[model samples]
Target: MTTAVLALQGAFAEHESRLKELGETVIELRDSDDCALAFDRLILPGGESTVQSKLLKERGMDTLLRRKIEEGMPTFGTCAGMILLAQHVDNGQGGDTQSGALATFPACVRRNAYGRQLGSFHTVDTFADMQVPMTFIRAPYLDSVEDSVSVLSRVDGNIVAARWKNQLVTAFHPEVDSDTSVHEYFLRM
Candidate 1:
């Protein structure tokens, strides 16, 4: 199956490399036109959520992506991508709707919920078949989600990974390491 990674900004290249290792061809997505015309599955990589959202808006991908997701196209979001998919975002930064998100998942999210970049580190979690080390950088801790969401992994009692329908999100960077199950799972969908 062919998968596309939104290459508007961020660690999209890393995601591209990992998916290649799984023997799947990837399309580096650009613009709403590309999002609209590209493959069935898409993965939005981690980056500055506001910046990425602005880029998506500028490129006209915002509407296209939302439409695709509603049409049942499988999507996987990491870090900032996860932030973008939230139904609500913390109003901590003066309640700017621009800081708001796509409302893809039924919930709220606070950017940098984990802390600063220096606070980033690795953790081995039990959710995967084997212990997998995940890298969290300026990550967002998932506070609440609807019943449709299933907790896939956690760290220190906080949910770090979860799934809703064909959509999956992780606060940590699995692509930083050598795991393909996550990407493979999306492919299967």
Candidate 2:
């Protein structure tokens, strides 16, 4: 299955490479126009959420993405990507650039919740009993969740991984470890 990676910026190459290891072609999605094709899934890589959202708005991809999701497009957003997919965002200390998410998943995310990039580290967590070694780089910890959402992983008592409907969001960069099972799951979605 072909999956499109939102390659506007950030660590998209890592995700692309990981997905490629699964024998799938990675398409760089620049805008809504890119979402027209019958892609099996979409990946929004971890980056700066406000910046990515601005780019989506500047490039007019936000509206297109919302429409595509409504049409049942399987999606995965990591880190900052998770902020874009969630329903709410608390920027900590009541200071935030954006408040709400795309509502793709029921969640409340806080950007840089784990501190800064220098605070990034690795952890071995089990998702559905699957030993997932993840690299948490400037990640956000999930605070709240909907009843239907499944907790896939966590770190320091904070929710770091969850699945809401067809959308999968992980606080760490699985791609950084060159792991593609996460991306593969999104593909199968």
**Candidate No. with top lDDT:** 2
Off by over 4 Å in 2: 95-101
For candidate 1, the per-residue lDDT at 136 reads 92
For candidate 1, list the clashing residue pairs, or say none: 87-103
lDDT of 1 by residue, 1-189 (tens): 778998988999999999999888889888766775658788989988888888888888788788788778898889988888888777458755333345687656667877788989887786545467788999987777888888888799888888888788888888887876677766776
- The whole-model C-alpha lDDT of candidate 2 against the native structure comes to 0.82
Q: TM-score of predicted model 1?
A: 0.92
Among the numbered candidates, top TM-score falls to 2
RMSD, each candidate, Å?
2.0, 1.7
C-alpha lDDT score of every prediction, in listed order: 0.80, 0.82
Task: Write candidate 2's Cα lDDT for 1-189 as tens digits.
Answer: 778899888889988899888888778988767867667788889988888888988888888887777677788889988988888888887655354436577888888887887989998887655787888888897888889999988788899989877788989988888556677666776
The estimated TM-scores of all candidates read 0.92, 0.93
Off by over 4 Å in 1: 91-100, 128-130
Q: After superposition, how far is residue 22 of candidate 1 from its true place, in Å?
A: 0.6
